[model samples]
Target: MRVVIVGAGEVGSNIAASLADSHDVVVVDVDPDRVEELNYSLDVLAIHGDGAAIETLEEADAGSADLLIASTDHDETNLATCGTSKVLGDAFTIARVKHVGFLRTWERSSGAFGVDFMVCSNLLTAEDIVQIIGLPAAVDVEWFANGLVQMAEFEIGPESHLVGQTVQEADQFDLLTFAAILRNGDVELPRGDSTLDAGDRIVVIGPPERVYQFATTASPNDAATDTENVFVVGGGEIGFQTARLLQERGIKPRLIEEDPDRAREVAETLSDTLVFQFDATDTEALERENFGAADTVVAALDSDQENLLVSLLAKRLGVNQTIAVVETGEYRDVFEAVGVDVAVNPRVVTAEEITRITREETTEKLTFIEDDRAEVIEVEVDEKSALAGEMIRESIPRLPKGVVVGAIAREQELVSPRGDTVIEVGDHVVLFVDERVAEEVTSSV
Candidate 1:
């Protein structure tokens, strides 16, 4: 498929990299440097021009493209690009925006902005943060099989009981499967002989209950409990959405905004939330508010530097968990290394979501793990598929290495996959595939 991506920023570049291997990708940007860098680094066409302009679209041959994605940081530009693409070409359009109002408007009316699909980065990031907060100990979480199956990543600490145990020894959960392990920045499929180590990020999939039970074992700190005192910094869209969602889940989080008007606005909008008109980075304010007793502190400030500082301060002040919204992917590692518990990148999340949507139609869901080194994909077993009416032991061996059957959903019932389990037609099959052989796994399964 020939795909045209507007905006050569982090989201656009990452999407181009993901689609370049399997499809024809063309990227447009106003910065010549970005275009030059993309042209030199990726196997895609990079045009230096205004993406919303008709001449630029014509230069990129957008009329014959299979898909056009607008991912600029500006919501108006993205919407305009999609609208222009719709008017000039027959390509399916996707617009990436950060405003929830736009999503609501598009939902109320189909193709409101001439977009076949829309991705809201702020909402996606907030939802991700909410998921992490809901399931403690999990750095990342994804659902599949219509929410029947859950896949989560947990970092093993030195105190974990399974730190030195092999996969076979750690197989205590009856319904959970050890999907993959990330050690030393490499992704590995856990086998009977594979041993888990401290600092290893392990991916597991199973029913929600089973996964929650296993989470406690993986990280004892994630034991189920009520988060009574939650602190949220920033009253921006991401922070507001997060606080609102948490409130809906019975959590009354205190939000801090430096701007008085913004704080007042949020306080009025959120009845359950307590909004403070003060600088979150102020030590005196944090101390006065008893931030030390906070169960969780989420830094959703506008600037990455400020968020990093807030998270670091929260940790120093004895907050149990600190989550920071870092826009740059490179800073995620830096944030984690500097004591930030979880780093949420809105751009990366948006890019991954868009890529999943653009993948094969048969793919019901796709989630990246181990920093895109591996993936968990959900596909339905149809009559023509190779997995139909086959036992796990017989069919799994036929697939490439590093690909494992994680779970199965048959008629709304969750099934933990095993050697004797038979995969029948109409069942939803979840598979863990290494990035190196993702295409092969997708085609075969």
Candidate 2:
């Protein structure tokens, strides 16, 4: 596909880097330095100009691009860029915005204005922080199709109950699957005989209700806590959204905004939460709030340096965990080195989201597939489906070609589908078919 990415920042560059391997990618940014860096590092066309300007977009041949992405830090600029690109081409356009008002009011409705999708950085960052805080032991969590299903990661600790267990013998956990393990930095799609040992990072996919139940088994029961008091630094859109999410979850949030006007506006909008006009960088102000008393400290300043510093300071001040919003990949290493517990790139998250919604039929949400030789697929059973009510073993040969039922989801419950397991109506079955026979397998399923 001919893809144009505006911004050339960490998120834009990461998107271009990931997509350039197979697609025609063009990166546009106002910064000549960034453009130069991306042009040499990635096999993508790099152009320097104001992306919000239609003229610059024309120079980059936006009219012919299959998709255009506006991912600059400024919400207005991103919206304008996406709008203008849509006018230049009938291509799908995605904009990265941060304002909650804009997200709630115009995101989906902006299709009339030529935007195919609107990604709110604040919402994405807040969601990431909330999930990470809720499941502190999990490395990552992703929900697909508006939370119909969730994917979670758990690193096998020395005391895990799963150590030395074969793939098939792992606790059923009622409705969750021991999907795949990331061991020694290698992904493995285990089978009945495959054994799991300590230090193996596992990725499990199931409905949220069951996933949370399984998560508790991996960690202590006390891991589930009601984070009632949230301290949010940086009263910008991201900070406000984070505070709003906390409030929605029945948590009382105290937001610290450096700008008095912004703080006043947020305070007026959020009657349920506390808004204070204070510099989060000021140790006196942090101490005044008893920042350590809060369950979580979110460092969401506009500047990456400030976010990193504040997060470090928060950690030093005895906060249980600190989350920082960073804009650059370089800062990821820096943040980790400085002991920041969690970091997120809003642009990268937004880009990944856009790609997911606009992806081709063969595309997968994850870049890393567990089994290179096998393909995992979700095939909904038609009500009148021939395979319905038939035992998997009995239907094995009757299947059109090469499909093998690995797992099945019926009424939001995941079951290890075996030869004796019978498929049912309204079942969303997952098949693990040999790559060579994936098409045949799907045709049969």
Best by TM-score: 1
**Cα TM-score per model:** 0.97, 0.75
Relative to the unseen true structure, what is the C-alpha lDDT of residue 287 in candidate 2, on a scale of 0 to 100? 90
lDDT of 2 at 341: 59
Measured by lDDT, the strongest candidate is 1
Clashing pairs in 1: none
Cα error, candidate 1, residue 155 (Å):
0.7
Compose the digit string of candidate 1's lDDT tens values, residues 127-183.
998888746667898888888898999888788888899999988887789999898
Model 2 Cα displacement at 411 (Å)? Answer: 4.7
lDDT of 2: 0.72
- Residue-by-residue lDDT tens digits, candidate 2, 135-196: 64465676543356666776665666667887777756654666666776465666678887
Query: Which ranges in model 2 have alpha carbons more than 4 Å from their true place?
Result: 30-59, 145-148, 155-172, 183-185, 190-200, 221-224, 258-261, 276-290, 312-318, 360-407, 411-445
